[model samples]
Target: MARSTTDSSSSGSSSSSSSSSSSSSSSSSGSSSSSGCHFHYVIGDKIDKYVITKYLCSGTFGMVLEVIDEQGIPYAVKVIRLIFRS
Candidate 1:
């Protein structure tokens, strides 16, 4: 699996709490997909308290991501794509 990182702005003290809260909510809802077809995750993206640290390799079924928890423990997460047939 390949690894990479994207650029993101540093959060300010005032916006930190709000952004964290929003990130938590959105992560739980799993509504990251903007096109409704696939999820494009970038470095620094938060998913259910886990922050994406790398862009791992992808396969036909889905893609793998390297994420870290609040404690700084790393983990690999596979995000499966859903295909609907007519």
Candidate 2:
């Protein structure tokens, strides 16, 4: 039997029905033609913690940083600049 290549939807415990694409990614893009897609989204908004410590680098893109959370755990956040146009 041949493996099917269709996106299957799933739901989280929160009753949220977001997408978890099976092959939209170049990681496995075959069926559909991608004009060009960029995946970027708000990060810390989901956490409600952490503080950005210092600006690490910014280029044609936006910014990066060294951050510390409420638990004193350090992390790096890369906030992209312009919205990607496909």
Question: TM-score: which candidate is best?
Answer: 1
Best by lDDT: 1
Cα-based TM-score, every candidate: 0.55, 0.38
Clash count in backbone of candidate 2: 0
What is the per-residue lDDT of model 1 for residues 10-39, given as tens digits with 9 covering 90 to 100? 222323333333323232223335324267
What's the CA RMSD for each of the models? 11.1, 16.2
Provide the lowest-lDDT 10-residue window in model 2: 1-10
Residue 55 lDDT, candidate 2, scale 0-100? 34
Question: Relative to the unseen true structure, what is the C-alpha lDDT of residue 44 in candidate 1, on a scale of 0 to 100?
Answer: 85
Q: After superposition, which runs of candidate 2 have C-alpha atoms over 4 Å from their true positions?
A: 1-47, 84-86
Which pairs clash in the backbone of model 2? none
